[model samples]
Target: MTYIKERRRILVVEDDIDIADLVTIYLHNQNYITHVAYNLEEATKLLEQRRPDLILCDIMLPDGTGTDWIRALRKSADLPVIFLSSRQETEDIVQGLELGDDYITKPFDPDIMVARVKKRLRPAPSTSENMVATGENVWRDGWLDLHFDRFEVRVNGKEISLPAKELQLLFLMASRPGHVFSTDYLFERIWGLDNWSDVRTVMVHLHHLRRKIENTSSTHRYIITVRGIGYKFQAR
Candidate 1:
């Protein structure tokens, strides 16, 4: 959000002088510590010097395009980014989506702009309130074990290697054992964007999760789909 930067850091990569100034002014009003770069060299230097929480980059830069920058950044990091460009064509939007979170056309409204920024800026709720840990790892029944401090999980007494998104999905579900989470709710809480991704993706991950951790013969599958509703992790 352009208005609240207390816990947020932002990188704005735009080659145009006027637009870059506009972006900095808006972000400054929001209280976010903002850095502006007009070229890939400056952006790279800023990246190596300061780690921003999110990046807003223009598609066309003096040194290179946003797509190239995205490809480079994603090689080592997972920072969310929103593309800013004058190109409004479908292909342009699609290409931008490949970059990250959201895309906005040149003539964007500040309110909508700030809203999208805020959505990505907010942090996810933790597994527990005590950010500081006591060192002992805990599990909820043999179904799921969380290393309260490490944010690691164990299922069926075996450690499961899950992708980033799947790991987030599992941790959120196990945070409240047996609590059924609707697709919309899960998407919002886990992905930070409501309906941004298809429900099928969630289903696929859950299916994979079950196959990996649950026995078909067991009456209680660790993650149970509610059919018409959504899914829940069986507490025990």
Candidate 2:
């Protein structure tokens, strides 16, 4: 009997040939379709050919820094990125975190890298099964209305557009109002089941989401941070 595997395409952007080959071998072992790009130029060509499910990038490249590449890519693409680099300094890690979804220091374990990749590629939970319905793909709470199918949110009849990730985060929290979600839980549920040590990913995305949905003048916020815990949706 033969079993066919679902290949999740991954773009590996690393200048070092040995490191790129090693990472590609590991990703292939995990049944992922891996494409290697030696620099930003090569990566750009590969991206034009086919968009990968995720990107594993090195901070230092022959042509330019990964930070610059991702900054430009984010303008058009919403693909998840993980930074794998030898630069483990606080500032370097913070820079990677700000630009990408996840960051890994160099001399990393192959298993851990594969795990992170798998998590990023994990399919989102079924919206139809889990979402609380107002009507069709819509979920409503007074002035705040979410149209999941349309990926549109309306606040007091005013429609606001959000990035894909931000919109998903809002839908998850708003679906279960008053339910407090821990960083780990939200990370796995929303971002996937990788390492939660770097919870900053959740914070950054949530901050962006809040900016879009939260009314500054209003005393009550739609999404409330639970201090020591995570966050919950509180409709006012």
Candidate 3:
């Protein structure tokens, strides 16, 4: 199927001129609109002018580390960020993940990077629009209500906030109630095929999601674990 996608805007923040140009070239070839920033200062300036759909950043910058910049960015925006740096240490990768959506080691393949960027920009697939819709762009099942346009979730009329990845995961499962999603499926769907991270990441996020949405006192659980398989939303 030939899918037509809107040109996604991407901000590439890398001090290395050659790397920045290389990334921008690849992204442009994929039909993405890109703005290159040599440092965090320039990136910040560009952000003030226009917000990009995604950000590609390097950890070491001329003015400050990308980690520090991202820490500050998180205070205001939830823009998906992918770290493109040479830092391959376990600690560095974990730290990047803690702040951003994904991390990529330096000297990365342009093809893989573009693929990851596309995955991040793509919206979660829904089985049927009417199946999930209670209202325009809204999904409701009993006390759980999800507003796709606003990225808001309300349980029992009280609003609850979730991280971007968790929200996407919930939307995917809840959109197709009773459909079992294996760990591999969920990982690839939410984290993307370019992600080499362990599948255990799925388990950790599921645990946190369950805690947020599941009402222990009630017999009804929003998300049900299909042991030895994966997980599914409890059918109404």
Worst 10 contiguous positions by lDDT, candidate 3: 126-135
- lDDT at 81, model 1: 94
Identify the runs in model 3 with alpha carbons over 4 angstroms from their true place.
1-5, 122-236
Against the true structure, what is each candidate's TM-score?
0.50, 0.51, 0.51
RMSD values, in order shown = 17.6, 18.4, 18.0
CA error at residue 24 for candidate 1, angstroms: 1.3
Predicted model with the maximum lDDT: 3
- lDDT by residue (79-152, candidate 2, tens digit) is 99999999989999999999998999989998999898888775644545433434344555556777756668
lDDT of each: 0.72, 0.78, 0.79
Please, what are the lDDT tens digits per residue for candidate 3 over residues 19-123? 986897687666555777788887898787656789999999999999999999999998899999998999999999999889999889999999899888745
lDDT over C-alpha atoms for residue 51 of model 1: 76
Q: How far does residue 165 in candidate 1 sit from its true spot (Å)?
A: 49
* Candidate 1, position 33, lDDT: 47
Clashes of 2: 0
